[model samples]
Target: MGSIDPPPIKLPSIKLDTTLAELYKRASPKTAGLRLGLASCGVTSAVDLTPDFQRNSRYPYQDQALIKVPRRQLTLDNTNLRKSIAKKYLSLIPQRDAFIAGAMPVILFNLGQSPKQIEHDRREAETTISVLDCAQRPDLIFCPGPIKIPLQPEQDHGHGIDKLDYKVVLDGLEANQDRLTRDLETHWFLNSKAALARSGLPTPRSEILETEGVPPEDPESCCRVCAAAASSSSSPGSAAELPLFPAKCTGPRGRWLAAQKDRILSAARARPVPFVFKTQQAFGGAGTWLVRTAEQKSALLAELAGDDSDNDDDDGVLGKLLAQVTSSNAHLGPATVLLSELVGADGDGKTVVGDYGLTFVVTDRDDEADGGAAHFLAASEQNTDGSNAWIGSTISYPRQEQLRRKFEGLMRQTAAWLARYGYIGPVGVDVLEVKKSGSGQGETEFFIVDLNARISGSMSLPLLRGHFVGRGLTCASSVSIVAKGGRAGFIQRWRKPFEEGRMLILSWYEDPEAGESIAEVVIGGENEERLQELVQRVRENIEEVTL
Candidate 1:
């Protein structure tokens, strides 16, 4: 089996003026200054930095500046100018210690380079930062998103900056974005038909097309169907059918309506027994269902019909399904409907293995963020195809030694690949872990599944924590998700259990101090007994925490 390495250990140094120095002198010696990227994307995405600043603002030194560089204009000249302006702003802020660059991917991608070219630009960009001042260099440089590179030691050795020290914030579900995208390119699955060809992985067979009229209802109506089905089945095809994974129909509503329905029905019938039905555009598990029998399918159809009545819609079941497929419309484009085969559990009760979502951050620094350091945040776990059950999660602050090595290796591989495409910054990779059947221990396998090209919720926690701490920080605790809404009431009702650690729930939305909106439950400390107590409390009051 291939081995995964942990990240390296390195921390950015914060420069402090008299006031900040005095403050640090009085506090823990381990405390370090942290610069936050308070850009709009960072703030709305909940990249936490407020707490950290609050805790450290009183330090002997502090620097503040709003660095605004256009996303579309990341030329070397613009980058240098931004850096110069940032330096000037720092000069004015009192007791400033260190610098943290916090530009996001939205801005980065707008630079208009492919994934591959982005790497060369990034290296050049980092070089610019390095040469700015020999006397006082920025201690840490963090991206608002995950770095789209694998972690590799040999390859990273000569870089002027410590790659490990640079951090990419990520959401929990999308940690492996970089790896998946790399795999996609490596495997050549960028478009729909290409994705279908690579079906050995967990992706659905699908297709993509541009049409002026509505989609065709007959299977043979479109050429994509002929191509997709031609390989697997000998059956004669129809014009409306297309062979693809997550098949998409794009055009005016009327032209595609009938064809889209036929495609959805065909997908439903063709799916294996005990499958799931999901609308393409839904998020956070919405518009997803498990269908074991025709009865359940009918029930779902009835529900869709009911929904249609409220809006005076004519499409009924098909329409609801189509709406779900197009929910991510703004981002994906207009009038597009996607239908994918549902992947489910195997007979052994293990969900069909889909892919693992590995969330990690890449920092410009060559070292890992300190233990319990909240400077970088990420969420990731293995996603199975069948049950959709997640296994092997690493949500809390990473053990620097354990995480860095793995991240570095992965980043090195990913970066090298992306360097060819002009894509840089934070990425989320969806991976599939396939295990051999029988022997109760067949060799386990890993494959890339999908990719998310932005900052994720997994990274938000650490950011928030760091903002609270006002230093480069990481958390040694795990944050558990609970139902949204009424979280405050739930926490208030179960405060005792939480304090006692009987319920080791970390409220993601709860202001640790104010205790509002307990979106997540947190559990910490080295005490096993305390952990257990929290677990029991969670078991007892789960209903309160869940919607």
Candidate 2:
């Protein structure tokens, strides 16, 4: 959080674009029906969630572990071990299911896990949901977890570990596809539509897949399928004319890494040193590196070049890079990196990053256009600790509607672009408005840095706001804190604040047998300042009580 001066210029209010209102109308729950939710953190975020790579590193799960257990007992207790193995992976069940209301019940699904593991994770997720008073919020059931079918010895490859998991889930889905489609809307939502498509499910829209340079459709096989379909006149559009995909509009990647690297070098020569390097494979800033000098960039590149030679299971930036390569294609040189003009401080400037995201649902598909359309659901302001680790999020109307309009336009363009590939589901876009030169007086610039085509940490803030505000609250924000030792019960000490409408424990899960707990609080206040003040008060109270 750097300090920034107020707007250097008077910003004009953006005239409301009918796109949002139209989208809202189209997505009314009356139009949207009950759809099954495929709730898994890793696979949805494009990260491979397997025991080999380990549980999801995203929050709710990232901090979940058995803190005080004896090492020897950990190996003996299969139940506790399964819970520990799948703790973080199960966090999304409640998080995603919270968005569903009405009679629409979701059948939660997960891959690379057993039925016992899924049940354990579901129980853990339900504990937090109960704390949030969301136990009865949505009608939900846990689908039997996917069975792991190991790859044969001859065909075993590093990639088969993930591929096999998808196969098991997809096979189960196909076996019961008739029953599922009959009983539920069966909307397949996960991180990678390409992966989903690989499971024999339909592919969804995703620019990440596009910029990764995966051809929109498999020219050899998929085109043949489309061609045969066209011969039968089964679907719309011609085989010769594929939809014109919009060029990569935002994020760090364009074309191949080789070309992207050349652009980075060019940008470095023109601007300042110490640029930002982000790996295409990382989620939650794990694959991000700060290249401080030419020497550092050279060293980092040298390390990346040796990625193929390294067998070390490191989870740092390099480890994440290698993991992404092994999970993706082998021909991609074992790693890919994106270099961008560092969005850090600008020449002795002091600035605070105004991080924001828009969550929307794709509503319509236009075969003529290269992409599809989406309806805006909510807006969220991300609160980071300045290290890219998300602290929490403030959900409110933007002070500058103009900036929001720009964000909406970008999202619409992105959604339409993704729609080209038949993707329709919840989509989140990450945008940043930086104070030019990192100073209050510096010129301001906003860049769309990342595109999360799946559910994200801040995605649920808007939903929480809708849920709470509808219950007669002024505003709402989601705050998370690690509950260490006595602080897991710190909520009892903050009873006065909860009674005063300063804070509400939306979801609190403290393992009865573990030392570390996670408390996800939905704090309410009359205004943004009051909400922030209440959050601070809660933190101060926790410190005193824990001490």
Candidate 3:
């Protein structure tokens, strides 16, 4: 990182009343037990999900395109993975048995699915609860499985009225309204704005598609505008552009994409270096593409001539390129695309191999309303594919005291800003560190690239922190691996690191016949230095191939 400072923030001009909303507190003498209902993968800015809410949105004001919030939806498979990971977390709670009986059960309101799909969700939930094996038995009132609803028709699947689908979701939610509200005291924590909308209550609001000046709630429009502004202001020493939040743009998809390209290409011409392309709605680094030369850009433009393939993972660079290839294609529209010059830390004239992030929790408690507080959880050095994808995180603990000091005020301000927009829950701000060159002393610059307003892939860090704190140890890092080729005793075969107490396997999901698997590991040590050592050892011992 270069000279240390908080990246510049562009505050929205639209002001609102600062009186804070009250959140459901834990059960107590004066308060009823908070029956928290969970809404997984609610309606997002992207069109892959239902467009009922978007259909009702008041957008595209005066030809100024409204950029909707970015979509971070997970697949049904990842849904199971999340539950499995959460099981390990539930096990980490030392007092799980004591609290289970009295703890209010959480209802996982999921996207509507078919009868068969509903069965799968029910089986997964049952397995999750059974695996926990708590003594008292929490009243985890999940349900008769995820409610089934009709999926939104693809852009090309239908034309006139047949294209609608959100109405089905709304109908389903309305049908279950009475059951959902059987317990008047239930508090709902939703994953998408659409879910919150369907609830018809305003206690917890989502600022996602409701950002000021972004009236349309259209993902393509919102993504392109905000991305263009971010790209222009992302130079090394310039004041950083506003954090990647909603902003407005105008015209159709082609114009928007061209504008973004010109902005990014202008920067490349100025610097003559590689740049990264990003789409707002993709996951697992799937929406990222690296453009190295003008010829490559030309070739990409040429390939767009007749490519109409719409199947396969649209979350990666290939999908993003295809979207661009057919920008005008009604089937694939242009939204949520952005570009930025690749910058990294340079130590002793050499690029270092890491980035850091400050992860914290934001809640809707009344006590914090006086002036929102940044409940600083832990800072972690992020592990990724050298781009936008987040792989894992290692808790840096008290070791980042210096960086922490620089970040304290920034964190508080950011949290407060988010709260102003009605977001209440987990928030992570990713910071990029670029070490100064030839300074002959330690000096670094920091930049904020992304803000995850919801749960992140690295959620395991906070859970690991709780466990380590209870054990009087600090967690070093959490690592995620996608590997192939393992045996029946794969865990045992990888015992050297575990035997050395360098790391512990948290969870693993594999396909034996296909010989492929994915897993997450938690590493630990007494302090930061020791933690780094443990991380290296774990990495060396765990081969990318064969478990």
lDDT for model 3: 0.38
lDDT of 3 at 483: 51
lDDT of 2 by residue, 289-333 (tens): 566777766655544433323332211233233322222233333
**Candidate 3 local lDDT, residue 456:** 50
lDDT of 1 by residue, 1-547 (tens): 9996534322223221212112222222332232112111111110112211111110001011111112112222343433322221211110011212322111121111356434533432343234222333332322322332222344323222211211222221133433232232222222222232233433443333222233333334445533444344334332111112222323234335556565555555555555555432222212345667778766655543333243332344344334322222223222232333334344633334434345443222223432211112243443222433221123334443454444444444443343344333344555554554553755544434344333332333332333322332233233333333444356456665443332222222322222222233434333435444554555465422211
Q: After superposition on all CA atoms, what RMSD does each candidate show versus the true structure?
A: 18.9, 16.4, 16.9
**Which one wins on lDDT?**
2
Against the hidden reference, what TM-scores do the models get? 0.42, 0.56, 0.50
The sequence of per-residue lDDT tens digits that candidate 3 reaches over residues 76-185 is 22334233322222121111211222222333332224576445444434432342224323343322223332212342122111111110122234434543422211
Tell me the deviation in Å of residue 88 in model 1: 37
Backbone clash count, each prediction separately = 142, 13, 15
Per-model CA lDDT versus the true structure: 0.32, 0.41, 0.38
Q: How close is candidate 1 to the true structure, as a TM-score?
A: 0.42
Angstrom error of the Cα, residue 535, model 2: value is: 1.7
